[model samples]
Target: MTWADSLRTAWAGMWSSKLRALLTMLGVIIGVAAVITLVAIGNGASQAVASRIETLGTNVLFVTPGPGTPFTTRQVAYIRDNTPVARVVVPLLNSGGQLSVGTSTLPAPVVGTTPGYQALGAIHLAAGRFLAPADITFNRDAVVLGANVSQALFGAGNPVGAHVSLLGQRFTVVGVLQPVGQGPGVSQDNSVFIPLPVAQFLLSTQNLSAVLVGASSPTAASQAQDLLTNLYTNRFGSASSVTVASEDQVLATLSATRATFTNLLAGTALISLVVGGIGIMNIMLVSVTERTREIGVRRAVGAVPEDVVLQFLLEAMVMSLTGGALGVGVGLVLVHLAPLILKTPAVFTPSAVVLAFVFSTLVGLVFGMYPAVKASHLHPIDALRHSG
Candidate 1:
């Protein structure tokens, strides 16, 4: 028989037992859908992390002290003076606090940094200005509102000159920052920025949370990181006393970690496809038994064993491919809705979809082979004489 004729026969056979065919395809459907959805979520999370790191800029270095080894302004100044490649060295202090404007209240992260903090990148203003040198020097009670904080406190009104209470202390709003969205560490959109000294006074601590360093160039960033690492290590008497990482190093580490997790999830999901293939094999074996008499009649009518094998194989592939198509639809729908439900990014990857579909087709082909060969090997006379 021609390939078209074999395919027609396969379709007829599956159509005669529609419910059974659908039941046989169920595993492939679930497997493909699961693989696509899980991979998409994993890829999305990786992309989100990468983007956040990229926003920190390649020319920047993040220096975070170990627990109980917080750096003071004097130490920060020494690093600034010593590291010639570093263009900007800004000390940062972070704390969680309640912000209130009139009766409206919301919990937000408060950042304390120098005016040089603005030079690091991802700092943009939608309305007024960022922290000024005078503000830090004078320890002004001035604050800058992040996009979400401004919205929560002032609604549609201008927040530049408004007065707000932060941790029960009244402060004047100096600026409103444009929305920077979520990132690796603290979310810029949900934070409030104040003078470093003011934060030190409010938190009643001379310690800093972190230090941000901007190098003159990407090539210089590595040198700056090494310089800072040595400085901290010598001061604290251990290499682990502080963590100094360039943005590229951080991105590479995060990418490797994310890739490992994504691969693990994909591998786990692939087991479902294998299980589904086994189910197909089981059902096909049963089909071969039930269709023994038909196979005998066909062989008696000049149909070759190869034709029988081809027909059965085609039927298995058709079922799996149909299930894969349906799975693609379901997976795409889930990818679109997942971000809303999970509150994280989920990107649809075409490569993942294609891979899943191809794998499912392969499953059908491989699992259906033995059943087809078994069906074809039956002696014609014996098959014809055998009772159902």
Candidate 2:
């Protein structure tokens, strides 16, 4: 028989037993769909993390006080004065605090920072202006509202000049920050920013929470990190007194972690496909047994053993491929709806779709082989004499 004839025979055989064929394909359908959904979510999460990191810019480094010492605003000044590689150093302090306008009070993160923080942190002004140099130097009670904070305090009205009660003192709103939604490692939408000295007075703590340092360029970030590390070690008498990490270092760590997580998820999902393959093998073996007389008649009418093998193999492939197509359709729909349902990003990758389909076809080929070989090796007279 020609290839087309063999394919036609296979289709006829499967179509004649539609319910059984559909049942046999169920395993492949579920396995492929599961793999696609898991892989898409994994890729989406990794992309989201990478995008959030990119927004922080390339030349930035985050410094936090470590064991054996405490970090303060004076350390920021020292870095600015001594380190030429570090172009800008912005000291930061933050705490969970309450902001009240009128009788309404809401919990928000209060950030104490300098004017250089606006640029170093990639914060933009939606109205009025960011904290000025004068505000820091004169230790003014000026505050900037993040996007969420502004909306909560003033509704649609301009927030620039509005006063909010914080730390038991009234602070004038100098600016409203543009909206930056939830990010991978930071959330600034509901924060309140004040001058470093103002925070020191109100919170009564001189210790800084973190220091943000911006190198002149990406090439200088490593040198700046090393310089700041050495300075902190010399002053505090130990290398563990300060922790410094550039954006590249942080991104590398995040990427490695994300990749490992994705691989684990995809690998686990693949187990279903293996189980599905075994199911297909079991069903095909049963099919060979039931079709014994049919095969005998075909062989008696000049059909070769190769023809029988080809027919059975084609039937298995057709079932798996059909299931794969159905699974792709289902997976794409789920991936599109995942962001709305799960409230997380879901990225559809064509490569993943193609890989899933190919894997399904391979499963069919491997599992169908044993049954096809068994059917082909049967003696014609023996098969014809078997009970129908």
TM-score of 2: 0.64
Please give, for residues 1-388, the per-residue lDDT of candidate 2 as tens digits: 9999999998998899999888888888877887888888997777654542445577899787875467777888777887788878888886656799998887676888889987776788899999999998999999998898898879879978888999898899999989877666334666788998999889898898778889878778988888888877787888777878887776787778887977787777677777878888898899999999989999999999999999998888888888888888888888888877886667777877887799889988998888998999999999999897
Candidate 1 wrong stretches, greater than 4 Å: 55-58, 64-116, 121-127, 131-211, 216-224, 230-242
lDDT of 1 at 79: 81
Which one wins on lDDT?
1
RMSD list, candidates in order: 6.6, 7.8
lDDT of 1 by residue, 1-388 (tens): 9999999998898889999988888888888888888898888777644543456567888787778776787867888898998888988887767889778887676888888978987688999899999998888999998898898889878889889999768999999988887665345777889999999998999998778889888779888888888887888899878889887787778778888978887787788988988988898899989989999999999999999999899888888888788888888888888876875567677888888988999998999899999999999998898789
Please give the range of 10 consecutive residues that has the lowest summed lDDT in model 1.
47-56
* Candidate 2 residue spans exceeding 4 A from truth: 55-57, 63-117, 121-211, 215-244
lDDT of 1: 0.84
